[model samples]
Target: MLRQLRGWSYMYEKIFDGIREQAHVRDELRMGLVCDACDLGPCTFDGSTSRVPCGITPDEMAMKNLAEKIAEGLGEYKTHKRHITMVYDMESLLEAATRMVDVSRSYSDEIDKLLSPYRTVRTVPFGLGGLRPEAVNICAVSSPRGIHDLIEFTRTPEAAENIECAGAHGVNIVSLGYPGAELAYQRGIPCIGNYLVLDNALATGCIDAIHTFGSERASLEEALKHFASRKGPQCELPEPKMHTTGATLDVTAINRAYERGNIEGVVVLFGAASPTCSWHMEGLVTDLVEHGYLVLVTGAHMYEGSTDAMNAPGVVHIGFCEIGKMHGKGFAPTPFVLVPGWKNAKILTSTLALVHHGYPVITGVRIPLTPSIEEKLAEKGCITELNGERVVERISELQSHREG
Candidate 1:
């Protein structure tokens, strides 16, 4: 009852337009970032009929050239490992795909080292004074509403406390599949599979060795059958409730969280899959946009990799729908965070997915398209937002040296 009352108070004090008025953020949230200075950049385009392709620097051009060479070396490594010496009849496709595959292998090798405590010296921090030194254990379950997942993990606050006591930094609950990617994005945690059909090989890091005995391969059907057989007819089990509406559930969860006054920020997860799901997700995005909520969509995931292997039409349709809505609303580009299981994490693919859809991702590296809308604001050296009639952040220069 207290929780519910608190939610009501939050709704009144923070969820309404008045909440925006009271906006305040901590100074620790800001960080000095190493500015990127890549040479040969890609062709630049504005939304209209303008194209500028020759602004790339010599260093950037040299880096791109070197990257292409490294790709060739990595392709040779893959050819040796896979025993496909004469498989490539054309050098062009091999050049492109091989470089990506090679870079991927090198990156994976690095992550494996980073995951180990002994390799601490080899680790480099990439964001905000380097990656925050934290390993977050996210206990998540997937059900119809997504709340079941959070509630299950936190059965009691004490139970949640136990995980924290065990050294978990933050908590993440993903009841629905769509939110998994976004939760992983905002929380900066890897998806450990609460309840959906996550790729078994990817989930377990058996992608390169699925045929080997060390990795177990099981289908959704096999899993259900195993569960049912364990029951042995003692009690009849009902059919699981199949959710045909992810978008609807997403909208419902957002509204509920807002009512609870727990939403400080939002990461929108909408894939261009299933026309029905896409339609609903797009609808939610539109609603959130009008309300000035920060929403990001991952439309390209709907059409990439294994995702594209299945629902091509659905993915394209969903991407187009999201694009249309964003264009119409003049909504800013927000990135779709990709939370594929570790070692098999498709961070680059996911980044490319959103870039393909023409939006900045929320949780990962911003795809270099337009200068980030945030960057646009930063051009003035500082920008301010109206919060309870107080200018925020912008006055820090003066406030830091206040006199009596």
Candidate 2:
């Protein structure tokens, strides 16, 4: 459906984050599991159990795939820039799926213990500034790793020589998504937005050269070092509902408001893109609030389809998935919960973490990982089916116990 993100990657002889944006949308929902475990076939199926030539069932393939996604999610911390003592045997999920171990304790304990330090309320400044007009702009998008990569390379003499050649006052850097509020605490590098706004930041025409530094993509050096001016018109970003804007999960505020019946409960959009297929972004959020749940549309979902949605009374645009969504996870035992769309790897980490904490994560997919895990999650919350009505019904049911 999203035909062209950035139309001139070839013109610059350099690829940008637009490619990843397109793939994120494609693989998360549209493409199901594919088993290339055997050379006989890279057979694709709709997460079914029809056995392949390699004797691996789709059920088995799904478990392996799920484990792999968790591993990739954990890799986000490798360059985490801080020490992490907590450990999760994520393979335990696969083991439990196969009945090797009774689903052990949720990973939420470990993740929460680790993230406890980053929980303080903070403002993450976004929207294209902090660049020296005379200097070259070294822009990067993708994983948190890409931010690190941009930092490391921009220091080398090789980079210095290039900026000197351009007669600029050193390179001005911009990092996207990670290290915004939680991880890095707003270093000089200003983050434009989450993964969803990668292309949007590029289209702003303020950035100079884009880099995929933290990416293992080949020839990143060329991209980091190259400058490609836009031949097309820059896109206009709409004014935000608030200026000097900030969004953070205030546990005390939420509880006080709920007790007074200001909100029935909380609904967090965990790495979900909206407006979803069946619902407009604002419509879904407005519906949730009307049902008495305060809706926190988080991460890329905040900007995926913006149209004064955040301006709605109950909606809060918490910046970046890792920071905002993790706060939502902290509410596991308290009843403030996260609602996730099984979108991507970062989302997989957040969703599984919440599931570990015993939140009944409602997703449209009937069988996301395995029937067993889905079944157990369903026990906590109903599996949403058909349209936004199911989700609204679930919200009503969850908040029904509040008695306010």
Candidate 3:
């Protein structure tokens, strides 16, 4: 599995590694102070300097930097959400609502209630011109309901896991964001995340078809058209679904996962990958799930045998953005593990957010940290390694703390 993924991920791994190396070098060169008021000189953080010229402490600077990264992640998700809502039509919306009713009715009354307004509406205008070519395809990938329905709808033998369809020809599945990528993968379509990773995936000479959601459709289509005209190399389609492996968890499913005695706790995993890392991550998740931990995964790791992991009976796949939504709805107080990928500033900031919110998190990958940052996180009782005994002990401590 690692070998195959390595082949697919080579281009992406190089790109990510290069960026991280460049950033690390830049950080090393920085004096680490930038005045908020004037974007002033990078003042040294040596012992001689108690504060930057702006009177900001090292702690303050760290917090500000973290805040900026968090804000950037928030902004990206907001934009994706906006695109999804803006492009969905009433008819497609109704179909999605109906499918939700069909597949999840037994488990969720909230979905029914939430979608009630859309049920009575009819004939929604095609709001975007790009949607006309294959409006259902666009809608199916964009909206939440559409995404859910598409996965359920595609889970048939006739559709197969990797069927060769006219529509899929010369196209690569450039899945936009978290849940979308997870859904596409379950349907036997290979997917890459949005942003820089998405660009690298397209450049790999493997994807001719662009299976994406939200505003990404336009850009991907433009790229695909260019590739098609030039007779570029095409990637082989992923194998069809031989079995139902992954289960998508919404708010209700998440709540139920907790309610059931089967789930000991929940752990959220995040990262992009090299094939080796992907393999190690999967092994770690499998071990955790076997021990009765309900693992909730997002980001690039979602494509790493996530569905197969669900066969362990304790793994629930979710979108990266959905983690905060779940956490916001009184879920933060729950003791869970946050295993972040190494070296990514975005993941680090997210880990910081989880730690700040008082969650017991254990890092799955080694965090690139300064001594100060490491000391601070340690003082807060955040685990920076994937030691099983340590994680269990920390979780017990957090649980006791909450109970008290």
- Quote each prediction's TM-score: 0.22, 0.52, 0.47
Cα RMSD for candidate 2? 15.9
Q: Give a tens-digit lDDT track for model 2, residues 1-404.
A: 23353445454444455566567445533433675432234455543435554455656667767776676468556533322223334444422222211121233333334444444433334444433345566556544444545555677787777657655567666665543322223233455544455565666654666665344233234433443333222324444321121444466666667667676666666544322335344566667777666666544334322222222336665544542244333442244344434434344444555555545456543334366755655664435453755667765665564344
What is the per-residue lDDT of model 3 for residues 1-404, given as tens digits with 9 covering 90 to 100?
99989887997899888888877445523543433322133344555556553456776766666676576578557544443335434333223223222222232334333333333211111111111122112223354444544444344454332333434332223244543434433443333443334444444444334433434434344444544453332333233222222343444444565576546566666544322132355466666666666666655334233443322345444433333433444442264755544323334555555565556767654554477766666666566655544554566566676568
lDDT of the candidates, in the order given: 0.30, 0.48, 0.45
Models ranked on TM-score: 2, 3, 1
Q: What is the lDDT of residue 63 in candidate 1?
A: 64
Q: Which ten residues in a row are the worst by lDDT in model 1?
A: 304-313
- Who wins the lDDT comparison? 2
- At residue 295, what lDDT does model 3 achieve? 67
Which pairs of residues have clashing backbones in candidate 3? Answer: 161-240, 161-241, 162-240, 170-208, 170-209, 171-208, 171-209, 172-209, 206-235
Better TM-score candidate (2, 3): 2
RMSD for all candidates, in order, please: 25.8, 15.9, 18.4
- For model 1, residues 285-318, the per-residue Cα lDDT tens digits are 4443333333433322221111111111111111
On lDDT, the stronger of 1 and 2 is 2
Regions more than 4 Å wrong, model 3: 1-173, 176-190, 193-200, 208-260, 271-279, 303-312, 330-335, 342-344, 366-373, 386-404
